[model samples]
Target: MSAQNTQSGKNDKVDDVSGIETTGHEWDGIQELNNPLPRWWLWCFYLTIIWGIGYSVAYPAWPLINGATEGLLGYSTRGEVAQDIDEFREASAARDAQLASADLDTLRENEDLFRYAVSSGGSVFRNNCSQCHGSGAAGAKGYPNLLDDDWLWGGSMEDIAYTVRHGIRNDVDDDARYSEMPAFGELLEKEEITALVEHVRSLSGEEFDAAVAAPGAELYADNCSSCHGDAGLGDRDQGAPNLADAIWLYGGDREALTDTITNARFGVMPPWGTRLTEAQVQAVSAYVHQLGGGEEPAN
Candidate 1:
């Protein structure tokens, strides 16, 4: 009977128990039941396709030859960020102007301004000056230690500001602090230089050969005393470093001293006047002055 029904085109079957229709197509006599999708699920799938098309049309979604497509809204995240940065710089301009105009003396009187300068200067130092002066500004072999009272130029606020702006022995600035120490290796005999090194070492209370240093004292008086002073108390005007102090810029070791005398040490610091704004120079100077090494300004 099933075969007669199938041959008579009545094979479109229904499950009598469930009352559901089955697809007429069958494989190995196993027919497939036809099921309709839920209405809510179909609606959700259609809505997503519409949302995607709308989003592509409104925002930058397409690629072009030179750039991305400018969508209907014409909005950009980068443009918004640039605008925000511009606004921030504009807001800070007035404060920056005030800082630039204020002198070191005036800045010190205003506690708020002083604090601001120090904070801002710290950031500037870390970014720009930390490469040579270390992150803590403790200095290295040739760099001067900023935490100590020994300043090759001067440790006063004004002096520090000047040095920072003009720099030392840098050719970039015409008015840069300039000084030169003659390489004594060419002028003096090796024995004489050796004696001078001993003399310099003895000035700092280091043990030295008395016989060698005695003759070295005469040489120092004739050659170094004019700038370094008779007592080795460095002259700021001449930029001569003090030999009497334990703080050494290069090193206090025998080899370091011998090299310095033989070749002469000429450490160069680059001028910040052209690189940094006036406010930044002032701020950094103030920050350095407050670092427990600054001296009272000479009256």
Candidate 2:
């Protein structure tokens, strides 16, 4: 009788209305449902699993003790990078080819090529030169402005190229551009330096006491006129700065002038020749020359 009762109880546990079974667990007298997953949800989950397997087989996805998977296609990140570079070079092949053959003058003559070179060179300049020459190319108190007409060295395309290729004041390089302004303080007396400063101020048409500059004129001719010329126009090859010009590479202040005379300042621009390829140097030179205020010097 007990066995029959147990069998009847098991039959009673099954739902009569639906064939779906319960979870066989209950909370607070409520049984949990064991419904099948929705068709769409199940399909999406299956698709992801299959896609993950395919991806793992096709590319480097698996990890091992030594390295990641080689995958079936045998692709490499380095190969992809090289391919990208080759594609870019191919697209700009004409410009690159022209740059290889063209001289600075020829490159400057072509408006399209010049524009392209300048744009590229400007970015390079900012990376390299902006530390000394401000981002705007205005330059610091000690450095010379690139945009201004006043250049310590000749502003010709070749000159600019040389400066970039071999940096000035670079001790490591023997070919680096270098020039030292004379330390006049060692040679001249305090009164004489004062007079000379007054004279220099007069040349620039800045306010200077005539009494002071009168003594300074004699000092100027004897000491400064050799390299700076009698009129203070300066020597291009020697990179002497014109004293008569309003623009001052270093500040025009008296203290600044005194400092220069006391201890000569050597502004060094590195030579790009050793650091960059010929093509890159050419591009940079062309860009600097075209920066406003550069032109053919009067004969």
Candidate 3:
């Protein structure tokens, strides 16, 4: 007999013991039993197939060239998120209006507005300003640190706001605080620049060779004093940095000072006035003002 029940001849012989019709095909003389599947199991299998088809039709399914099918319901996660954001913006509308118009001078006097500004400004700073200035506003070598009192331009509330509004050394805004330091490398000899570097370092109370700094003084008086002042105390009006103080923007080392004087640093800051909203500018100004470096407005 074949292993499978594929016998073609009429062989409806009954098993002598069970009296059930047997398949002629057999293995080792054992007959095969013919049975039908349980009705319950077949019904369950059909129901699952129907459910899958219905689900695919109701929701997003089937990939297309442009995108997935939008489905009959037309629901989207992006739309839900946008709705939530719109609701939040609507709730803050009044506060935002007050913030936009409030005077910067007395903003801190109002506890509510002050807190709002600082909080909002912090978020703005992290999002926009953190790339240059650190997340904590400590700043990098080229950037000015917000935590310290040292400022190239004045750090008063009015001054900070003005700088933020117009920026420094930027070409986009005509009102930007414009000042240029001549690249001494082109004008002065190599020895003269080195001597100037030594003199500059000595002014900060660092150890220096007096012999070399002697001639450098005359050079500094003629070339740099007009902007840096006679005592190296820096002129805020001109945005010249103070050399006499210990705080150094780039670095205090010989190499750093040498580079600055030789090639000069022409750093540019973007004018926030054109980029941000009036309220946003005010908020960031308020946040920076509270950072310890900020000064009281001049009397």
TM-score-sorted candidate list, best first: 3, 1, 2
Q: Write the per-residue lDDT of candidate 1 for residues 242-277, one digit (tens) a residue.
A: 999878999988889989989998899999999999
lDDT of 1: 0.88
* Model 2: residue 275 alpha-carbon error in angstroms: 1.5
Order of models, best lDDT first:
1, 3, 2
Residue 130 in candidate 3, Cα distance off native in Å: 0.6
Candidate-wise lDDT, in order: 0.88, 0.78, 0.85
Q: Tell me the number of clashing residue pairs for each predicted model.
A: 0, 14, 0
Lowest lDDT 10-mer window, candidate 1? Answer: 1-10
Candidate 2 Cα errors over 4 Å, as ranges: 1-94, 297-299
Local lDDT at 62 for model 3: 80
Q: Report clash pairs, candidate 1.
A: none
Best lDDT among the predictions, by candidate number? 1
lDDT of 1 at 213: 91
Q: For model 3, which pairs clash? A: none
Q: List model 3 lDDT by residue over 105-222, tens digit each.
A: 8888999989999998888788878898899999999898999888888887678878988998988999999788999999999999989988898888998889999989999999
